[model samples]
Target: MELFFKYLQYEKRFSPHTITSYQTDLCQFQEYLKEVYDLEDISQADHAIIRSWVVTLVQKDLDSRTIHRKIASLRSFFRFLVQQGKLERNPTLRIKAPKLAKKLPAFIEEDAFTQLLDQSEFSADYKGFRERLILELLYGTGMRLAELTNLKLADIHLASSTLKVLGKGNKERILPLNTSLATSLSQYLVKRQEAFPNNNSPFLFVTDKEAPLYPKYVYRVVKKYMSSVSTAVKNSPHVLRHSFATHLLNRGADLGAIKDLLGHASLAATQVYTHNSIEKLKAVFEKAHPKA
Candidate 1:
């Protein structure tokens, strides 16, 4: 199991958070096997045993998406074992998780973002500059929270107006930064240096204590600012990302271009934003058409 974890960490290049979730799911399954079937080795478990565990997850009334993720973990673990010759066959081949409902990704309206960024008044201090930059980058680049947190000072190329984002699986992609966002980023750097004159931190975004930015800090800043402009239930960083993609698509950006900017591994992942665009079109049609 430890070797498999190392494989995921070193070979797969999955983020620590993802690796921890996989570990949690596998450990829970191991405990279930120990308590219910007296099984010692997960490699020896058959498809029937794996299905039974999934059944228990369903009985717990877990969300279908959560159950599906757990099942996916089992599938990946068993597949790795088979490749390593620890098991003859994968035990999760027959295991099926409940189907997930098709829900469109939630995004704040473009006018809300315009109000948040253009009309809002942020302080002139370092903290305010940092907060403004966080919103600009998330909504401008469509970067994931992990990607944003992992960003370093070296990733920004202000002269070229581009950003190098290290995405999932350690894939690096260069995103074009608009001139306005580039100017904002450049100004933030000045404020950052002014705030921490003698301190040396390699990260682009940092706490007031001169440490690298963390998830919760970014979330709090985003939630606080977005609340004033958006009434959406989810006023989070991801909503900003969704707004970025949806707004671009609504303005006639190509699907493939948005996919590359968003760092999606497949077109299917990028297609979700199109649903939001379609919903917007439906709203316009209902409001403007002659027929009721």
Candidate 2:
């Protein structure tokens, strides 16, 4: 297990959070093995034992997705053990993961998004402008909260109207900023300087003490503003990102372009937003058609 985690961290370059989740899932699997089979090492794992574990997981009322992830983790772990000569054959090779239904992404409506931004009160104060800018950038650029929180002053290219975002796997992508969002960012930067004149945190967003903005703070700011606009959907930063992608697809933006803008590795990841747009179009057509 330690070897597998080291491989994930050093070779696969998994994020800290992802590594932690992998650790948790594997630990749970290990505990089950200890209790059920008295197995203490990967070399003793076999197909029959793994299948019984799957049955046990199902009996525990775990969701299909959770069960699927555990299976995937075990499969990878067994493969690693095989490669390391701990096992002669990988038993999980024939094991299948449970099929999961594709759930549609949640998004804010277009009008509600506009109202949310317009209704957000921003004072001349540094924190107010800074918070507003954070929200604006999330919706405007469709960046993930981790990407936004990790942004540095050097990442912003105001003259080019682009932001250098370091996404998952330490991949860097340049995302463009529109006129309005760029302008708002400029104003907020000035206010930020005034608020923390002597501070040198380099991060674009900072706290009251001029420390770098944490993910929790960004989540709270998004929730606070979104709660004022609508209570239908859960207010969160990712919702703003979904709103950004949905609105873009609604406006006829190309899927490939949207994929690049959102820093997705594959077009399939970007295709989910089309489902939201299609649902919206269906509603509009149903309302307007005479032969309903």
Candidate 3:
């Protein structure tokens, strides 16, 4: 298992978050096998055992997407073992994941976001500036939460109005900064320097204590601010990202251009936003069209 983890880390170049998720899924599966079947060796599990585990997950009412990811983790692990000659056949080869329903990504409306950014009052100091910049960067660039947390001061190119983000698989993408976002970033940098003149953290955003930003901290910050303007069930950082792409698509930006900005690996991922656009169009037609 350690060898497989190392392979995922070094050879596959999976991000720490992804590697951690794989580890968690495997551990949970192992624990389940141990408790249910008294099976000590995961490599000894057959297709029946794997399917049973999937059934147990379904019975537990776990989300289908989560169950799918767990099965994927098992499939990858078993395949690796087979390639290494430790197993003659893969246990998960016949295993099937639950089908996922087509669900549109939830996003904050443009008006709500605009009101959140413009009308909501942040403190008139370092904390306020940092909070504002966090919202701006997430919506402005559509970067993932991990990418935002990993952002470095050197990644910001003020002169060119660009941000270099290290995304999944360590792929780097440059996102253009709009003038308003750029000015906000410039102002935030000065405030950051003023707040921490002696501290020299390399991250673009940091905690109030001059330390690097963490996922939970960012989530809390986003939730706190987003709640004031949005009634959406989810007001996480990813909603800001969804808002970014949806707003762009609503404004008639090209799909390929959106894919590039969002750092998506393929067009399929970016195409989801089009569903939101279609919904908007349907609303317009229903309201404005003469033939009802």
Best candidate (score: TM-score): 3
Stretches of candidate 1 above 4 Å error?
118-121
* Number of the top-ranking candidate, with lDDT as the measure: 3
TM-score of each: 0.94, 0.91, 0.98
Error of 1 at 286 (Å): 1.8
TM-score of predicted model 1? 0.94
C-alpha RMSD for every candidate: 1.6, 2.1, 0.9
Tens digit of per-residue lDDT, candidate 2, span 233-292: 678898888889989999999999999888898998999988888888899999999974
| Arranged by lDDT, best first | 3, 1, 2
Candidate 2 contains a number of clashing pairs equal to: 0
Pairs that collide, model 3? none
Better of 2 and 3 by lDDT: 3
Choose 1 or 3, whichever is better by lDDT: 3
lDDT of 1 by residue, 79-139 (tens): 9998988888887888777989888888887788888888778999999999999999999
